[model samples]
Target: MAENMTGDIISDHRERMLNLKKYYPFFRLIDTSFSNFKDGKYEILDMGYIVMAVLRFFIEENNFKEKDVTYPEYLDFLRLILKRDFGLDLNEQDSKEIADYIFDKIKNDGRPFEFSYFDPVDRKKRVSRMKIIESSIRDNTVWYSISPDAIEFYLDTKEIKDESRISVSQLLLEKMINSQNFRGGVEVVERINEEVNRLKLKKNEVLTILSGDVFAGIEAYEEFVKTGMKWFDDEEKLFKKNRDLIAKSIEKLNASGSTGEGYYRTMNEIYSLETQLKQAMNRHSELLKDCTEMQKMTDDAVRRAKLGRLRSHMDFTSALSDMIKRDNADILVTMLSPLLKPNIRKTFDLISIDDALMVKPPRYEEKELISNERPEDIEFEDEIEEKRIKDNYVFLMKNLIVCLKKSDIITLGQFADAMKRAYGEQILRNADFFSFFVNLCQKDEYQLGGDAGEDTFLDAYLGEGFKDTESFTFAIRKGLGGQVILSDNCMMADVELVRKEAHGE
Candidate 1:
């Protein structure tokens, strides 16, 4: 079966090569040791070479460093390279076996030949067997084996060797378990448990609220009831009728004041009546709200549950892709950058060219100079109060200074230009003014403009002063509040710069 599969792969490659030759008549095929035919079919003499080529292409394309490579790394590398470079899609099992075969050859060839130095031992002769073992120990080629004699000989010879032999199965298992691609299965299980518990707790709370077994505070409710009864008793007709009865009760209470029994009886009656009135008034309000809230919560929970499985699957796949591409910075840059159009090859410098598309021109609101309230013939000596405060300009200048102090940008010149473009001319006078502030804020020791000292023109126009700089610094700090602050800074700086530098200034 394996031989037949190998023949099929060779035949496929030959057909592909022929198709390529039809399209490009000048195409040439390179000859290698493995490119040989036997029994009317190509023999796969150098499967290891083919596997290595695929692995190398993946590593280079993905920017995978040499140190990050592992057993499963070679497997994924083979899968991607086969699909991407040769347009060959391999299933999981085929990819794994291919990777295993490559690694096995590398391991075998890396060590010296085991049978080269020692003669075969005769088991019947104990002395000869012992001699053979000793001889094998002396030959380093025997280090690859996991046999008891090999292990004992290695331990006796070397002080730093591991006591246990590392098997291929153990290494492969460890690689799979530790790999970022497969490890997230544990996290998915944990999140599922958490979500389940949360749903259960919410359900219990809703059921409790739906039931009308709630108790009010005993003392406060009783006092409130007594006050309501007292209000009723104060009415003229009611009070007149109850006056004699009330006096009799007061007299009875006074006579039994020392006993304390009658006083407790009177207080209990008042509290009971008050509780009845309050309960009837607020009967359904609490229960209705609770049921409505519970229904809303149930709807939300159902929606989340419906999406949970799909979301989890998406999360796992995204995480796997991220893990595979973690070390491949160049590939990520290529994937993310919009500059990679069709067959165009993007260099490092050209990666950020798309940012130019983000630039937008400024807009201004025009107000009429004359109001409708004044007649066309009416003329008055109205003086316009020009309240010109330099605070905004000063603030921007100070900001530029702060950017310089942090060494985030070498010069404020470029930052000033970005600010002018983002905000418009009403705020920043022009690039010259922006450059002046940057130069004022920048250290004298640094050069004007080389790779080492690139200028930030936007920072210069905003302000080169310490306070403004500090504000900008604080705005860029990480977290929730920092985002708002940064946004405000950008808007204010952009707008003011545009307002001031509206002309070519």
Candidate 2:
């Protein structure tokens, strides 16, 4: 049955391959174009290079009118490229001859060149077809450009390494800033919109870097952090600079700008740039936040990995086996320390307390005498050998509440300081202490420090802070009224405490 199933799968694959061949006849055309040898003359006309040339041409001439390059113009461009780059001494005539042959093959193919792409959804390789579409013709010259489909296919199939990961957003942002006529017409606005879309796509790609089984590793996490941090720094600076430029442009326009249509168009351009800049900044913030979170998550994973290795080396069974090999009865209690209980519940057998208390005298035939006593109620030790972790949560909470009560509200830094003074730095050293405190503040038991009418509760405002200090400026409810100083270096969050309202004089 298994053999039959395997045969069926092979048969289906072959059938699909045949169907693909029939559906995409352009492959044969491309193959024939390269296979043809007119005395080894057209051998220099590489299909891959030809595709690249067309792509480069379309990119260079991005405008609608310019997309359609005349046949003579394209021939000239190809001649220059081949001669300069390939060191080929092909003249215009030879270049034209080769270009015509390539174009003829393309026209006859009726389809595009197909490249294999890994389809993550289907978990298989699928073909992406690429082609240059001939757009228009004038007199004797035919104008052509790359089709959107082909361009998209190329982008999707291309493998970009980390070193080559360029920020399209930064490039476009800079271009708009430098261009004198950026706010000219619909074309410029449309181009900006296109750039915005491209930026969004790039931003989404950053999110996908640490996703899936392909990159769910420590190395990927590190790469994500490195890339995201650098991008945030550079893009944030550009965003601010562009924002300033837009502000100045707006000010100038407001002072003495155009009238009617020009006025509306310029305002619209400013608004668009501002909106895009804001979005870019927001995206950078989110990416940075995600990178930070990924760092924490990967740190946890690394710690767990270490724990797994430790577990494999030092399980109870292995330790017990070692203990038995050494024949160390003195260390038996030590080996069983983890399993020893503070108090053992006794099982009540049918025997009465009187029977347990009674002593038995050995007969002459008996080997030994049995003495009975109720085991003397043995105490384990000063500390239980059960290895149970002590619960400090309640203890910490009590200390925190006492501090909060003393002061109407407190910052995380202040709280940490108080806790350090009370319980020493060891209690404050717990990594999850801040997170636990934040969660506790959100409970119904604690109230915000606002007047009778106002709605202010114990809330936290996120800010950059020093190490071993809170990253957020916290207050009891609406207790934070005035500006809180957030300094650099130690970046500690400011704390404010609001006094509870007095009931009577």
Pick the TM-score winner: 2
The TM-score of candidate 2 is 0.31
CA shift at 419, candidate 1, in angstroms? 75
Show the colliding residue pairs in model 2.
448-457, 457-477, 458-477, 465-491
* Winning model by lDDT: 2
**On residues 85-152, what C-alpha lDDT tens digit does candidate 2 reach at each position?**
76788666676777677666655433345555454444588654444453544542446665543333
- Compute each candidate's TM-score over C-alphas: 0.14, 0.31
The Cα error of candidate 1 at residue 120, in Å, is: 31
Model 1 scores a TM of 0.14
Please give the lDDT score for candidate 2. Answer: 0.50
Worst ten in a row by lDDT for model 2 = 457-466
- Residue-wise C-alpha lDDT for candidate 1, range 71-165, written one tens digit per residue: 45556766766567656566787656555654454343223112211212221311111110111222212221122222222223332112111
